[model samples]
Target: MTYELYYWSGIQGRGEYVRLALEAAGAPYRDVAREDGDRVLSAFGKGIETPSFAPPFLKDGAVVVGQVAAILLYLGDRLELAPKDERLRLWTHQIQLTIADFVVEGHDVHHPIGAGQYYEDQKPEALRRAEEFRNERVPKFLDWFETILERNPAGPDHLVGDRLTYADLSLFQVMSGLSYAFPRLMERLYGDYPKIAAVSAAVAKHPPIAAYLKSDRRLAPNEEDIFRHYPELDP
Candidate 1:
């Protein structure tokens, strides 16, 4: 069955992580919202017995899953983007959860007051938050990921085992987002996290991923998306 993915049109946002896993694995799926954007709102807390709180939900037959991490976890196992061993699978899930946390924190740097409020209204708070995020949280998270890659018994090429996993793909997306959102900071710090950069490069160059990135299926990053570049905030 071709999976139907529900997310806002014109931006990757959280849905991009799910899209990455699907594209990497060459799974059959459709961006439902991209086709008929208004159609996506129909699933928002209404039609399905288990309603999604927001977009980026997956409908694979009767199994409807929301949340980027949960959707990726479900797809990881089914798409063979995870290790067969239960332990490794759980480890991948753990990593994905951490990535989700990192994403939220990164987003809050711009919208420090509230997600609903305009960034302009909270520009002062955003500046402070962005400072902390760039100085403290950025290094902390990247360092943790770097350590994970360094200590992986298999190698630094992949986040888990010898093969690529959904976590690895997600990490790649995270790195790319960071770079886009904070190019100046990333340009200075990315060298400090060589393994993470290597993994990001590998994911970008992966045959299927590379193709999807070039195709119209891929949505380019924009200020409206999860990773927004603000010269003042980032600097």
Candidate 2:
């Protein structure tokens, strides 16, 4: 049976994380909102005993899962995007959770005041927030990823085991989003994080992902998305 992925129609937000894993695994899935459009807003406050609390939730048969990491966790074993060893599988989930933290930080740069306010409304605070993100947070997050890749006994080719896991695809998505959101900053810092750069490059070159990127299915990052770029903030 094909899986159902529910997320906003436009913008490659958190949904891209799950999409990458599904694409790499060659899993059949329907991007629910993209097809019917109304299902997303309709899904809210309706259906299932437990509320998703947000979009980017996945539905497989009677099972419904939300949160990027949790959805990926549920899909990992089924899609072969996790290691057989339980410890490594949990480790991958840990990395993915950290990635989620990093993603929130990225989003806050533009919405420092609140998600309810416009970036223009929070421009001053966003500038301050972005300063910390660009200087302190980006390096901190990238450094951790570099260290994890180096420490992986299997090799730097993957995050958890020798094979590509949802964590790896998530990392690649982060790198891609970060690059689009901070091109100048990444160009300056990419040299210091060779392992992360290598992983991003390799993930991009993977046949399934490469084709997905070329296909109409892949949504482009934009101002409406989490990783929005304001030129002043980029500097």
Candidate 3:
């Protein structure tokens, strides 16, 4: 049976991680929310015993899993998209978590003061937060990943080994999300991180992902998710 993915419709949000892995693996899965408008709310209302305390949950046969990273791990193992070595698998998870942290920060840039509030209402606070994100956090995080690539003896084909892994896909999603949200800032800031740029481009150019990019199912980035665009947030 094909796996079922439940997440908010329209925006990719956290759901895209699962989507990317499934797509790249060429695995069959149903995007439940996209199929039904109320699917996400219905799943939440049903009080499903979610593993990660969030949406973007996955249902694989009888097992239910949540959290983007965990979902990727589950899918990676089942689909053979993850590294086979134990050490490499752990490293992939570590990178996935770091990407998750970056995602949370991206969400905070617009909702720095309050996620429940709007960009119009939190403009002043968002400006301050975005400045910090653009000037400090972005470079720091990118530099850390760049160092990982430099330290890796594998020549950067994968975050862990020579094959495509979930972490590489997540990194691609991060780059795509950031570019959609802050095109100018990304262009300006990403210049220093060659490894990141290479990974992003490579993942996008991958056969499965490249085809997905050309498909209609791929949702466009918008204001609803973590990587939101705000003109005021740009420097």
Candidate 4:
């Protein structure tokens, strides 16, 4: 059965994380909203037995899963994108959660005062937030990923174990978004996190992921997305 994924059409946002995992696994899925924008709105308005608070939800036959991490958790076993060992699987989920936190912080940099407020209205606050985010938070998050990769008993090729998992895929998406959002900042700091960089490179080269990246399905990062590139903010 082909999975149905509901997310906004034009932006990658958090939905891209789930997309990466599905693509990496070569799973058959339809990006529902891309084909029918109204479907997502209907899902939100009409609601389901188990409604997701927002888009980026998945429908698998009878089951509906919400949240990027939760959707990956549900798909991990089925797609063989998670560890078989219970402990390691949980570890993978933990890593995804951390990545989710990083994503939120990245988004907040542009809308520090409030998400509802335009970036122009909050430029002063965004500048301040971006400074700390670039100088401190980015490094801290990347450093932790580097440490995890170095400490992984299996190898540095992947995050949770010797094999690929959703965590690695999610990390790749995070790194890609960061580079797009803060190219200068990442260019300056990325070298220090070689392991994190390696993971991103590996994921990009993965046959399926590479194809997806080149495909029209992959949306380019834009100012409207969570990872926005404001030159002044980057500087």
User: Which parts of model 2 have CA positions greater than 4 angstroms off?
Assistant: 44-47
| Weakest 10 consecutive residues of candidate 3 by summed lDDT | 43-52
Per-residue lDDT for 44-162 in model 2, tens only?
Answer: 54866967888788989988898999999999999999998989989999999999999999999999889998888999999998999999999999999999999999899988879
Full-model lDDT for every candidate: 0.91, 0.91, 0.85, 0.91
Q: Over 4 Å off in model 1, which ranges? A: none
User: Candidate 1 vs candidate 3: which has greater lDDT?
Assistant: 1
Clashing pairs in 2: none
Provide the lDDT at 199 for model 2: 91
Candidate 3 residue 43 C-alpha distance from true site, Å: 3.5
What does the lDDT read for residue 146 in candidate 2? 97
- Root-mean-square deviation of every model: 1.0, 1.0, 1.5, 1.1
Q: What lDDT does model 3 reach? A: 0.85
Q: Cα lDDT for residue 234, model 3?
A: 78
TM-scores across all candidates?
Answer: 0.97, 0.98, 0.95, 0.97
TM-score (C-alpha) between model 4 and the true structure: 0.97
Per-residue lDDT, model 1, residue 73, is 82
